[model samples]
Target chain A: MPVSNSLRSLLPVLILLVLFALVPLLSPSNRFLSLAISAGINVIALYGLSVLFGQTGILSMGHAALVGIGAYTAAIVARDFNVGFWLSIPLAGIMAAIVAALIGVPSLRVSGHHFVIMTFAFGQLLSIILTNGGDYTGAASGLDVQQPVALFGLSMDVLTHYYLMVVSFVALSAIASWAIINSRYGRTLRAIRENEKLAASLGINVGRHKIGAFVVSGIFAGVSGVLLAYFLRHISPSQFASFPSIYLALMVMIGGARLLLGPLAGGILVAFLPELLNLDPVQSRILYGVCLIAVILLLPNGLIAGIVAGWYRFFDRRPVQPNEPAVEREGK
Target chain B: MDVLLQQILNGLSIASVITLIAVGVTLIFGLTGIINFAHGEFLMVGSIVTWLAVSNGVSFWLAIILAMIVVAVMGFALERGLFRFTLERPTNGFIVSLGLIIVLQHIVILFWNANQKSIPRPLNTVWEIGGVRIASVRVMVIFITAAVVAMTFVAITRSRYGRALRASVEDRDTAALMGIPVRRYITGVFVLGSALAGLGGGLLIALFPITPFTGGTMVMKGFAVALIGGLGNLTGAVVAGLILGIVEGLSAGYGFSGWTDAYSFGLMILVLLFRPNGLFGGTSGPKMA
Candidate 1:
């Protein structure tokens, strides 16, 4: 695809992101900011998920474990040593990546349902360890992350944290994801997703690329988890369990994992729906599940594509150029 | 000797419940190829319905029967509304089932509060032999689950519907081409599976305390058992469920209670890694998306 066409393709996403960036300033309320920050963290987290499910074609019901690992790393370090947020946060991502690599290497060999189960078992075991690790993980009830990160000698406040989450977490992820997807690495993952045997036959290091995608995803989850710990200021086993992975899956699907800005849309909806509707946990979870099923049935391609497909149908119009593929950029 | 006997008995009772759930899950997988995570929700609701019916002055046995009918109907509706479209895609079916799980748990919670509820055993007696004491309810659970499994075996081996279902599982398209009403048979498999889940739930209310959240663990163990036994392998599921029950029983009994959950998951992952084809000889068939 041409550069102008690719930029045109990303126009809608850019517009949506510009609107999201202005939300904190426009709303100016702690409650709203909290939701935005939570969504922002999830958006970052689900980027890894998109890479896994959408790009690498692996379903990890254990992605939450990576997040937990990251959060635990940050919380344990900060609580014990009173380390600053910057170092702790990056360390969280690095630790999560390390753990992801460890778990992913062996498990990634198994594809489809078996692979999903492997990750799920891994996630469940990690949760058990965190809950039963006693003083180390603050046990099941959770640990208090009392210290906030300092940026330019500014102790963290809600607004500042929100901005930090957006800039450091979301922007950094988007840039990294953009860079990777644009690089040969991204094309290789998409190739693997489309057909592993064919890609391998074409001289791809299939296993390495798969592990690399997972590690990159783990990094995203770790940073998001670190942000979640700081944002919530309290972390618990319940916060990072199997359900969170499903919840992340819901967001990715709802926003359209195939689209660059899909997680952003998904993140905002999932993070705020409970608070916005004042729904109890049960009701909210039910809603999420219903939403997930609805998405899978009606929007298999994802929310953006589904909506676009519906729009095109309503208009009964094919693309203006029959010879050109609409928005086809070879995984970039 | 008494302790060993006790643990063995304990393991048998738990394995019976697991077999009921696992067989149901594997049955659906065999016929329809959906790993209905909401299958455990049937078990949860079955118990809850039995509790509600029994508390409302119905006879315990009658309530159990009613629960089975109700859940079977619910299973039918879910099959028609949701699972039908997902038959071709196992992954989509999984996501749909996850959705159903969320939906079913919340629906139950909406009607019955999330508080854990325990039902009094219908038999309310203990049988003691050789210094090993056993609750009559436990005996009933084991016996009833055995009867159900035996009946299922007979149905599969002897009955026309069972033959058709088996054929469908063997090769869905061929079964259809050979004039088997494949979709209807698949639906029957789901209803029968759900009924088994209901029966397990009914038995469960007599022996174990339950809440809506209990379905999560039930599904995990059921799915694990189904995998270990091999998907669609009846005998394999039973053996796997028994092994899992014994392992869990011993772990809980021997004071490694905190690690028991981890222990079960470890078993599942190990099976997944070492025996992806399954212990009893069913091949892996989940399609890659």
Candidate 2:
């Protein structure tokens, strides 16, 4: 008999774990290690976006604001209340989740277009408030974050912080995303995405489910924000504008919205490419725009989904017969 | 009293510009069923081209017309090349427009060098009435907008092409079956919308300076107008634009100036809350998500 199906499916997870374990063993230079760490941070947020767009089909373009909220929360809490990273971390996620639910409640109740506009407004409103928030938010100049979050009474360096983030939050976030996508709630969400009316007819509260997805996505973004804040050591309103939201949306699309590993690939592409290629900011942005158009027109399901589907189509075709039974013909 | 009157005038002038831009968006949405984010860039194109023409010594009237023609042609080419492919899919159209936003802005910046450009106003004389001062340029803007709105009203109500556009917007397949060239009319709407946006941009030169990056803010305002008036509802768009202007004016005038953008956004949120179909109820339009 074949091995257990659960174990078989976990093979991919095992492989990824092994790869991550081997990451540090490669003895990468100071720079490569730093790049890898930032890529990891981006991946967490990318996965959050995947939950919203990929699983829920919400197409929100404001995850960046949630990320910013998370970052700001962490920075402010640390600066004012003298909280450690550990406490600030959970607080950030909670704060972002509340804001997401607040905005998502009414907007998500409306039609999809309104939802898009509302999410955009959420980002814009956040930036505006931050700008006028005066000394508390440091206004337009933004607040510089000090005090590295210490663990076990010891302050960590950049290199050690990278490992801790990767080994702890990054791994946990991935596992949590995997669990959410495979759970009963996840099944209902997927159903709603496929056909909202049908799902509602079947007794699924579509609105509630959509809100749940938004909150979960917001939590992911918040955690990612915390990571981003730690990485940058600063927090500001300009950092959270709709452009970053669009960038997150772009990253999700580039990776293929529906694939588990898609955002992982996408985050890496977005984070590392500009730095490695030394591309002009304007040129890189133009490249993103062109790629988005090309991807939608030529590969609407995203790059990975397109490739996998194409591969399956190539080798899985069945010959048609004029005399085939109706059932068989239908399957063909 | 003078301040209040002047603010009201400012609000009306702004409302007219917003209505001009919002109309273009609503027209495209009505016919093509896509929210064209690049509509603002059309305004940008119009302004820049007009500025270039004027600075190079072209007559102001000739420059504005040339600006309209160039932007309209660019709109037609974009529709045929890029937008036409995404017509049946609103979601794709949305994403494609975002892409076009990036591409168009950069292309403008690359050629124009990302500098703010302003034209010397030919009509700078200020008119005073009851302690309120109104720039002659403001008067010109209001007059031109009135004439254009009237012309547009006539075109949509009386002309054959306008009838075809309205018919297709009401029901596409039926219009096609009824011998209307639905495809051509859709493209025509795209061109017309672009031309209107271009002309609005040219008109804005008398009021304010512009840069290649200004399109982002304009598009946001256009979206606010479109949402407030119901998406795809032209009449609603016009009313919403004026309402936005008045709200912004009152808020900015009354010392809530720092929160001007906030007030506009808050109004949009309120509209989305109370009149999800827009202030003047219209079709919900297609939901993409």
Candidate 3:
């Protein structure tokens, strides 16, 4: 890469990395660390979702199931078989990815409301299975997990785990998002989203692309789930319910799904919005519902897209070429 | 055999309540091309209103009718105020309806204090035939629900209003070109659907307690049944409703009592996987159009 191109490419991520490294050192409080950890987890999960939602244009209402799969897989493996945390975490993501692929075969056939309902039921079924599997799965109370594995000779502690989570959070989101958005696969997925029939006519395998998106989404959700389980030390069916999935989708929408900064903004908002408002549990939900409405009405293309469009119009100092009228350019 | 009969009766009672909700959902989808996520909230409003009215010295029958009328008015107001402007954007209407669900839910909580309220059943009569005992309230619900279903079926199929509704569903622009009052028909359908939902809610009050959050599960069931029997197919919705009711009843009966609640949702997922168009959903081509 050219020197200027490399610097331009690395600048934003370097800034983000510096910010992540400084967060814990500046705050150092347990509560802040906890909140930061939770937000990190959400960012990771939302990363996978942005790929499927922003790239493939598939709206899944049951993504928490994939997260649950990751959490439970990690929990069960680490607890029952006493596997290392590193080994168990990846296993959780793989398990979720496999299940997502299986479901995607049929789900990719349906679109719009049909796909939404399909994913919704899939999430419900995952919860039911966890709740019904009495002794082995611990039924409704959810299973518990063991502590983190030491990295070689180094002992793992909570603060260390928190930083590790932050690193993974930044790395997974930035790398995965950059890779997908720039790849040929991502282009094909975008084509499918724009117009599936047209994409098929152009020799794109729409179904395979959709399944790949679902699997990739599930993989991210799973890894996030494992991190969540490790951070909390417990996993419950309630944690993976439909409400969280809806909240995740809303977060992506509010932050701007197609933008890298969108999930980060959303994760922060979803985490702190309730606390900032000091809302009671039920009232918090009402506020969330209202927020969803406000976002949809005001930000049709999402907050990031809105801001970008506004920024480009204001600061970009290109002369108004009469032949290249703004309206005609925008029409494309 | 008696246990089976009792279970069947129980299933029928459940189906009676679900049929009302499902049919309303189907009607709204058919006529307006809008999915009212808040349809369950209307049921919630119906039940809460009936409970409040009856507790405040109104006759049960009067309270039930009053609830239906009130919900119908709310439906009309909704169409006139919000839905009419959103006809060009169905997706906007859907998301807005979800917002309405939260707003309505909070309003209920604010008024009713989040407590579960039970309506008193006036009927103490019971029938024991061939060693099977049937609660009079269940029998009453079944008869009333059956009558409503029959009347609704006839009204939609034979009446001039029904023909207009059918015309609107077939092609909204063509119906307008044919000089049919499309807006009036849409509003009427919304009102009628809400009335049925309210009526169902009132009847359901005899069997179960009502809470502010009760409509969420019921709405999921309505969606499931509507999908299974096929959207825009009234007869299919009715059959699907009964099938769902029976599935839940059997799940509750066969020692997996808690699993009963998950049965419909599970069935919905399974059906979507195998038959995305639903069991009787005809013509996959026009699903979106």
Candidate 4:
């Protein structure tokens, strides 16, 4: 049953990949492909956020800073050391993970609101440092990723090829996220999220696990950053500021952070919704704000979770159990 | 000596504005447990109101008052309509405030356009003491802020409502058990905090140019003051605000203007590392569960 459940979960990811594989064949506009590629990169990072916020119940508002660190690391190395995109991927991931662990150490000491505020400050601090990094960080204007990603002896500068590359990465990230969600570490993290004190009492190293989750998320963000840098061919301090961090958090929150398809659903919806509606950037942001508030009020779990629950209720036809405690229902 | 005096005066003025914003932030956090990310927007809205009033021939002083009143009403409405529902889950409240930040900012942008707005300083005279020169506007801001802080300090420490507020902050469940009407206090605190933020915004625009986006940076500084002072501790906020303002003023004056924000944030990170509850220890604030 467990094997089948795992396989069932993988089915949607497979479908998603198959659908992505069809995008190039349809011959969509370069602009559309670019948006898809951007969304795919964001989806990769969102998966990491899912593990941290969804499974571990730790929300790092500085997630974008980690992404920034990865991008900057890749860009700097590529610029100065003649490091190619392939070589910089692991370097970026390791650098982001190290920074994440460093920030997570002191931040994890304070839980709840303080943790949120601290991460927020850290995000701002990273942007400030990058902006003031002078020529080393390329300053406020930012640095260019001159190294193009080459796969199979072909440069992926074409929109279709790049989209395919991003899609493949998305698939790989989704599968890895799924594996993590089903792993023993995932369960332990969920236990910590459910009740830190109880988990601590049950012999869990809650602090270490929280830092581990952050480091893992940082690695994911780092790879996503690499993809983003190469895709855009430019990286800026402003891109990874506190506002962008908030934007990433908004994506995860809207998509249902805990579910397998949440990141994909959220990433696509947020990336496409404004474009599809033809709304300007300001109007779309306002809409996102309203949506976030409404989601929190009406569907606290998230859009995907709410939809899944609705689907279950429609099919199950279970009698109303009024006297059953809310906690017991949650336990089930 | 002259440079030191000038920096001290500048720091005092900066601290005054931060104190107003930080106090409101701490008060709201103390009572409602929401970080109120939109508190900066509340400040922005206040500055907008002040700008509108001043443009329409209202006195700058009256404009500040109008801004505060308008923002206070906004606070009441948001608390009653939106934030009241999220009391059971503070994290949701925080997220809701994040949404509110975006919504409020863009709404301001949609209506007013995202251009920097500035108000003529109400007092343009400079008072020179020895070799040091201080703008009368800065002095006025410092005096006004000091008065407001004193009034708030006295009210919270000595008044009946203040006692109830402190009690609610200490423990919501017990405060309600004691018939303190914690709900009403929460509303009152929210309104007061919003009003203070509005005043801070009004003062902010008087000092510098402001855009709809100014709130982001201001709010970070405000939170730094609030957290460094101790999240819910009023006196701590004032002290932290002073320290932050001085640090920022010194950094800016010493030709490290670009890194002034870095200094404040770095100080905050260090304080958080050493004293997670804030420098003064946030005992007067709600106990973290």
Best by TM-score: 4
Per-residue accuracy of model 1 over A37-56 as CA lDDT, tens digit each? 77888888888888877777
The lDDT values for all models are 0.80, 0.77, 0.77, 0.86
In the range B1-289, model 4's lDDT, one tens digit per residue, is 7787888889889889988999998888865676688999999999999999999999999999999999999999999999988776666777789889999999999999999999889999998779899899988898889899889989998999899888887777788899999889889999999999999989988888899998888787887788788877889999999988987887778788889878668877777777877788685245533
Instruction: Evaluate model 2 with DockQ and give the value.
Output: 0.44
Question: Where does model 4 exceed 4 Å of error?
Answer: A317-332, B287-289
Q: Give the number of the best model, judged by DockQ.
A: 4
| Tens-digit per-residue lDDT, A1-332, candidate 3 | 34565345345755775677677656577776777778878888998998888777777768888889999999888778888778976798899999889768765656665666678677877888888878777889998876655677575556756666566566766677767876778778878877788999998888888999999998999889888888788888878876677678778877767666677778888777787888877787788777766666666556656666667669975422111110001111
Span of ten consecutive residues with least summed lDDT in model 2 chain B: B280-289
Chain B TM-score against the true chain B, each candidate: 0.95, 0.94, 0.94, 0.95
Instruction: Give the native contact fraction of candidate 4.
Output: 0.67
> In terms of DockQ, which candidate is stronger, 3 or 4?
4
Q: Rank the candidates by TM-score, best first.
A: 4, 1, 2, 3
Tell me the lDDT of model 1 at B149.
89
In model 2, state the lDDT of residue B242: 82
TM-score of 4: 0.95
Task: Fill in the DockQ of model 1.
Answer: 0.52
